[model samples]
Target chain A: MTSTTCREAMREAIREAMLADDRVFLMGEDVGAYGGCFAVSKGLLDEFGPDRIRDTPLSESAFVGAGIGAAIAGLRPIVEIMTVNFSLLALDQILNNAATLRHMSGGQVGVPLVIRMTTGGGRQLAAQHSHSLEGWYGHIPGITVLVPATVDDFRGMLAPALADPDPVLIFEHALLYNAEGELSAGSIPPIDRAVVRRSGRDVTIVTYGGSLAKCLVAADQLAGRGIDAEVIDLRSLRPLDDATLLDSVARTHRAVVVDEGWRSGSISAEVSARITEHAFFDLDAPVLRVCCAEVPLPYAKHLEDAALPSVERVVAAVDEVVNVRA
Target chain B: MTTVASPVPATLAPSDVELLRRMLLVRRFEERCAELYSASRIRGFLHLYIGEEAVAVGVGAALEDGDNVVATYREHGHALVRGVPAGAVMAEMFGKVEGCSRGRGGSMHLFSVDHRFYGGHGIVAGGLPVALGLALADRMRGVPRVTACFFGEGAVAEGEFHETMNLAALWTVPMLFCCENNLYAMGTALARSESDTDLTVKAASYGMPAWSVDGMDVIAVREATRRAALQARAGGGPVFLELRTYRFRAHSMYDPELYRSKDEVAVWRERDPIDAIARRLTGAALLDADALEALDAAAMEEVDAAVAFADAGTDEPLSDLTRHVYADRRGERGPEEERT
Candidate 1:
């Protein structure tokens, strides 16, 4: 096993996939000569050349659609749409073309396309740039959504995603790029099951991507208060691992959802609804949620802090469920 | 202007006559489609490729039997010229199942896998990348197939157009980027939208060989397409051709024609490709008045048969509306099976 940052893990995973399969290639705004905007693909252009590590013009729709096209033509293309917020421009291609091509083509074609986009808010990038729209994406059918929260997961989940016949959206959290952990980058796992980060019996905390770390920190604090919280990191978002979530929630009998998207129509709301419907009989109390405050993320550090879901908020949400209903 | 020795002068008489016949058919099919639209037989967004028939017929003629084609919404001409029956296109307009794409594609989404005609994309500049990929696949497989993607000059504003071209040229994919410069994009004219009205320059910037030709002349479009198609098929990589032309009708059925004047449309009409070809054929004694009438009759017969065939088509059952939403044939396994 080798120690590496989450970003390096991603770079290594992409390099391995490209080396293994000629079909695998990548395209995005600064993916080539300038390396990746986040440095995930720093030395890639030098190794793979421009054909494999393509840098696209400012048009997200074109590159995204091209990726979809390449996938349809049997190339496993990984399209990077800089940020989830900017992905709105390529929504037509992503939703209409990539997501729907296989079904629309009556199975004659499958878009084995992986779109890696940075999601969640924390940086002072404000309204237009900062957004957590993975929930909105999860609503669409014919696509698989995955969020790798750990260095090991960042490296392991790529092969399964690349092997899938349909399109997959890999939401990489902007905050975790620099986070370091032990990782075995050379190997890949095919399982789509959610991994339990910390096992506790009192309450279950379900979350993915940016909110996973916060939930873990909240879990540690809750351990201090003698409130043992079980943490479930949802690796696959679209084909949600409901059995895993329900099994954990059933054991704990209480749950708290942590999502970084704004309150209204966020993934947290959807998770809560799913838990209520599927694991309702086992629940002792209502499903609690810790989501970002409902205003557009602002550029100021303090306001941005207030706009996102924090450990304090997660702890408070746990208290409301464990303290109030305990 | 890197001119190749002017392609041996159009010595092929049958080919020239076929071009005229095909152009006339698209013109008539769309014209009749316009009339039917007034009668409420066709509905939804209808983008007509009336004046731009030469581009479709010309480029489509050079495409080999197995070559792939990806076109835009104004695609009846492209689909029909690519060998999809006009009846199916008309029925698609009427939302009938007999239509190409099983009537799901209508005017903007006609698709026929049998012909390798990918689709009639509704979004502007949407088909470029798909074309690049098609070429890429052919290149990888060592198949001598060419993927021709057709779009309007207005689509140049779309980022995908440039990005796709760059990738195609960079990767040396076998593709022909046919820009049907009909001068207007819906209400937005090319001059108002493009900073440089010359589209070939845009392709040249990406380091691809490009040319601008008279789209108003069927012979010119055919010659340009034949050369580009041959070059792309011969492993010369992607070539960009800007067919300089104008739209005779409004952008779509709903467009009010507020953007350009009737006088402008009339001026371009004087250069009508169909009439030009017919006149040239008559002058050369390759086609007499009788042969010209015969060609018009055949086209009319083809359109008539297509319309009747569409009218006989059945509507897709509501139960199967979700058929192709997920899997092609083997769908995602049930949640339990997916885990395994």
Candidate 2:
């Protein structure tokens, strides 16, 4: 196992995809000479040159639509929006063109494009740069939404996304770029399933993206408190792996969904609703959620931390569900 | 405004006659569509290309096979001129499974991949960026081809128009930006909507060669598009042609057209493109009154056959309603084959 940062792993993944297919190219603002907004594409410009590694102007709609057009014209383009907030500027193209073109064209055209954007709050980037809106994209039917929490997933998700023959949006947590983890040499995991990061019997702590690491820490903290919690990282958000989630909930009989997005109309709400819809009889306690406060993330470190989901919040949520039955 | 006598070719060529026939086809087909809409045979929004036939036909004459074309919602004329079968277009308007988009997209979303006609995009200024990318793809692949994008002058008021223009110019991609300036954008006149009225000046600001042509004259539009398209296809970067035209009909079936006056419409109608071309052809002794009548009958016959085909077309089954949302790539290959 090679220890690498999530940023390095992502850079390596893009580099590898470029090497694998001549049709694959990277386009975004500051991706080439600037080495990506988060330094995820450092040194790629020199390796791949400007033809493959392109730096675009701050025109998200144009470049994203261009990516869709290039995908239709038979090129695999990886369009990187600097942040999730800016994706709103191109939301028209994403929804009207990228998401609807295949069905609109009656399956004659499929957008094989990958759009990667930084998401979530923690480092005090303020309201505009730090909202977890992956759920909004997950609600879309035509595009696939992926949130790669681990270094391995950050490295592995691109290949499958590029090969999927439809538009795939990868939401990389801005806070997880510097997180270090072991890069396993195993085969890349399928982008359609969820995996149990840590197994337990007391309760299932469901989460994804930036919240996964916090959930893992909460599980360890819960273990010391004699409350064993199973941690499930929802790698894919749109096609939420219901089987994995329901099976774990069936055994545990309790769930605490943690998400960085707002509580109302969020992915956590969707997950909790799905659990109640299918596995309501098996649950001993109500499904709880540890989501961000319904406010724009502040710039202050303490306020930002308070707005986002934390390990303490996860631990407390699990305790609430675990104690309900005790 | 008075109609200026356009310089007609001394002798009409066979290609020029074909251009006039194609324009007549568009005019007749849309006239029949208006009647069908009134008869409740074709529902939903119908935007007629009544007086703007010269733009589509003249521009289409400049394009070759294998080149890409992206157009806006008022795209029946574009699709017909691009060689999408009249039956397919009519069936699409009828929302049948045999339509070009398999009845998925109605009047505003006709698509024909076989003809390389990308879409009939509903959003204003939406197709420009996509066209830029299409050209970018060909440029990256070292292929010499041009992607022609058709949008109304209203699209210039959109940010996408500016953004796409800059990107296409910066990338030096082969793109032909065809702006059909129909004097009014929906109900808003160009003067009321845009601060500066000259669209060619707006395009020229992006460092691309821009031209404005008399859209009512089919030969003028054809010559201008041919020059611009040849330059773009020869890797001369992007070129913009503002086809100065007018829509003689209301914007859509729903419009009362309170924005413009009947006198203005009558004035523009004096320079009717089909009538002008027919006059030129008759003056040159290429088309007699009987021959013109024959061409008109043939167009009506084709429209009749298309309407019949649409009438007999089948509706898509309810069971397959959710198909093509995402491509069904299941059972094709395992994830193992996708690994690097």
Candidate 3:
């Protein structure tokens, strides 16, 4: 086992995938000589050469759409869109082409494409650069959404994501790049299913991506206060491993969904609704949610911090659900 | 209306008669589609290629067997000329399971993986990048295949058009950007939409070879596409061809076509691609009046067969509505099996 930062893990994963298959190549805004916006692909261009590590123009729509085309042409292409905010420019291709190609072509064509984008708020990148809109992608049906919160997942998800027949979008938390964890030697995490990060029986905190770390911290704080919270890392966001979530909710009889996106139509709302619909009989209390305030993510550090779900906020929400009178 | 009359001076092939047959096929097929649309047999937004048959047939003739094609929503002609059976294209419009896309994509989204015809994207300029990527993939694999992307003049206004043009030129990918400039973008005229009217000039700004051709003449379109396709296949990088054509019908089944005058449509109709090719064949004594009638009759018979196929095809079951959302898990082991 070895300790690796999420950034290094991601770089390692890209390297491993390229090594495994000649068809795998990386293309994005600054993936080549500029390393990457976050340096996740720092040394890749030198190792793989230009054809494999393509440095594309600042045209997200073209490159992303081209990635879909390449995928259709039988190449596994990893397209980086710089950030989730920038991905809005390529929404036409993602929604109209990548997300619809398989079904639109009636299963004759499948775009085995993987798009990696930095997501979430915390780095003070402001309104344009910050905002967790991975949920918007999760709402899409023809694509798979994955959030690799750990070092193992950071290294693991890429290969399986590239191998999947349908398009896959991987949201890498911008802040998690620096976060470190231990990856067992040569181990990669599964792309599907939610893993129990922290097991408890009193309440279930469902979260994924960047929020997983905060939920774990909140779980620790709840434990100190005599509240046992089961933290579920929704590794696969689109399929929403209902089995793990429902099992956790059934055992705990209480739930709190933590999300960085606005709550109105967020993944948190979807999770809360699923629990209400499927596990209502097992629920001892109403499901509570801790989500980002329904305003554009601001630039101010403290305001941004207040806007996002914090450890205190998650703990408070968990307390509300756990302490509710039956 | 100002299509330059620079028909190539080189000798026209006897197979040129085949061009007339194919264009006649598209013309007859689309004419029947118009009648079917009025009869309410095929519903949805049906964009007919009535006056634009030459562009699809000409470009289709230039493309080799392995070359890729990405076209716009008004692509029944493109699909038919690119080797997608008229029966399948008609069945797609009929929304039957036997359609090329299994009826999932009606008229605007015809697709056939076997023919390498990527799709008939409904969104303007959406297919450009996909075409560029297909060429990029072929080039990377050391395959000498050209990807021909067909879009209307309306797509020029889209950011994807500019982005794709720049990337294709910058990367030197083997791509043919075939822009069928039919004078209008749905209801809006080209003069109203674009800042500069010359599309070839706009494309040339990206440093790729660009030119305009008489889209009303199949011969011109075929020659231009052949030149561009050869340039792309020879690793000469991406080239752009602006096929200056016009649509004789409404943009869709519902369009009133209030954008242009009937007189303007008449001037374009005088140079109808099929009429021009048939006239050429008759002048050469290779085709007579009776032969022309026979060809038209043959095309009508083909369209009838297509209608019969669509009429006989079934509707997809509701149980399979979500079948293609994600590919079915095949022999591949589950994710759990990968945990070491």
Interface RMSD to the true structure, each candidate? 3.5, 3.9, 3.8
Candidate 1 residue A232 C-alpha distance from true site, Å: 2.4
User: Compared with the true structure, what per-residue lDDT tens digits does model 2 show for residues B1-340?
Assistant: 1122233433567558888789888999999999999998889889999999999998898898889999999999999999999999999888899999998988898899999999999999999999999999999998888899999999999999999999999999999999999989899999999988888778888999888889988888887788887888888899888888999999999999999999999999999999999998887778889988999999999999999999999999877777788877556533221210
Q: Report fnat, model 2.
A: 0.71
- In terms of lDDT, the best-performing candidate is 2
Candidate with more favorable, higher DockQ: 1 or 3:
3
Clashing pairs in 1: A62-B160, A107-B328, B87-B306
**lDDT tens per residue, model 1, B155-256:** 899877877888788777889998888887888878899888767777888887888878877777778888887888888889998888888888888888
Candidate 1 chain A — worst ten consecutive residues by lDDT sum?
A100-109
Q: Candidate 3 clashing pairs?
A: none
Give the share of true interchain contacts found in each model. 0.42, 0.71, 0.75
lDDT of each: 0.82, 0.91, 0.89
Q: TM-score each candidate.
A: 0.87, 0.97, 0.97
Candidate 2 Cα RMSD (Å): 3.1
